[model samples]
Target: MERMRIAVAGASGLIGSALVRSLTSDGHEVRRLVRHEPRSADEVRWDPEKGRLDPAGLAGCEVVVNLAGAGVGDRRWTDEYKRRIHDSRVHGTAALATALASLDPAPRVFVNGSAMGLYGETGDRIVDEDSPAGTGFLPELCVEWEAAAAPARDAGVRTVLTRTGLVVARGGGAWGKLFPLFSAGLGGRMGDGRQYWSYIALHDEVAAIRHLIDRDDLSGPFNLTAPEPLTNREITAAMGRVLHRPTLFPVPAPVLRTVLGEMAGDVLGSARVVPRRLLESGFVFAFPGIEDAIRAA
Candidate 1:
């Protein structure tokens, strides 16, 4: 394996932390761009909201991965919160791309974090990187989110936008928020629960990212999901089965619409996305099945 110098923004977050661990443990030089003064050698300081980063700190880094963003489900989707979500991603991305473009020794690869929401609610359609981007708030966000990375791309960086799926892990993301409710027997299918849930185990999620980073031929929007896409009802039932609990509680569509508003579409709609490129690139999944993922998580 080629040892390289890497820098990751949002290293405190779940996926970012996992990537940092994986990169550093593999004998690569990994540095984290943090919001506060870094306490270690492998850390740099940057404030995305203020559009500030240490250009000098980024020197000699060959790979830069931007994972900074406002959490989508962290709060109710008020207009202000929505704007915050959009601005956070756009501004952070713009700042990084601009910084990288100005560098004399620029990073060769820039992995930009996007979401499967870029495809909107495609029902049963299996969209890939070449598919036309859909319309809707999320799709719009992704469109702009990706546009913000143009500066780096124009600077000759090999840019990759990971249109990621629901990442199931131990502490956070979709599974973390849902696990407690399911374990307490309060979990159930929301709405019709027929929408496809294109989810990936966190292990594969991180591994595929590392794979993309190492592969120079891979670029553009890559759907980072599993081979199998399960429905909401299926995921709920699987969780119950894993814990030997019953999942029968139901959240009506009306209630979801009222609570999540525009987000209701994402919460209830489907994105049966497939990683066409990952399979083509010969990457293997560590936990391909949700049952194995839930049990192991």
Candidate 2:
């Protein structure tokens, strides 16, 4: 593999941190964009909210990946939190794209973070990169989020929008919450459990990102989900089978709405998303099955 200089925004995030480790361990020069003072030579200080990033910090970097964004599941979806979610992704993307555009010899690739929530509530209707954006806050947010990367694309950089799905991991994200609950025998499916969940194991998720970075011929939106998406009930059974727990309890949709407010829709929503472009690009997933993903998680 050819080692390259890469700069990453949101270097502290769950996916970002993992991606940095993968890159650096492979002998690639990885520069981290941090909000605080640079703690080391590898760290660069930048304020995405203020639209400030020094091009000098990213000079000569062959690839720039912007995974910076507010965690969608970090808190309840209040109006304030919704705005934070929207602004963080848009501003961070805009900052990175604009900075890359201004570079005399800009980076060759720009991988901006996006989510499968772009196609909200698919309800078992399988969708791909060509699918139209669904109607809702999430869809709208994703539209704007992807649009913010226009500067890099217009500058002739190979731009990729990774429409990531639920990442099954041990320490953070949705799976993080699920692990503890299932371990304690308190885990169960939500609603009628018919909701389709398109997920990717964290391992595969990182691998997909690296694949995108390496593929010079590939650009545009790629759904970073496993090929076999399962329904919520099917996932519950798999979790039970993997973790050796009982999948008896089920959280009703009304109770979820009462507790999660606007966020309930996301949990109850069904998005049978497929990674058509990613697969076509020859990226392979290590954990394509929910059972294997749960085990990995």
Q: Report every candidate's CA lDDT.
A: 0.88, 0.92
For residue 79, give model 2's deviation from the true position in Å. 1.3
Please tell me which predicted candidate would have the highest TM-score against the true structure.
Answer: 2
The regions of model 2 sitting more than 4 angstroms off are none
Q: What is the TM-score of each candidate against the true structure?
A: 0.96, 0.98
The pairs that clash in candidate 2 are none
- Across 1-297, the per-residue lDDT of candidate 2 in tens digits comes to 788999999888999999999998999999999989988999999887667888899999999999998899999998998988988899889989998999988899999999999999899799999999999999999999999999999999999999999999988988988889988889899999999999999999999999998889999999999998899899998888998989788999999999989999999999999999999888888999998888887
Q: Mark the 10 consecutive residues where model 2 has the least summed lDDT.
A: 46-55
What TM-score does candidate 1 reach?
0.96
Each candidate's number of clashing pairs is 0, 0
**Residue by residue across 1-297, what tens digits does model 1's lDDT show?**
789999998787878988989888999998888888779988888777667876888999999999999888777888999988998899889989999998987898999999998888889887887788789888999999999999999999999999889998867887888989988999999899999999988888889999999899988888899889999999988999998889989899999899878788888898888989889989998888989878768
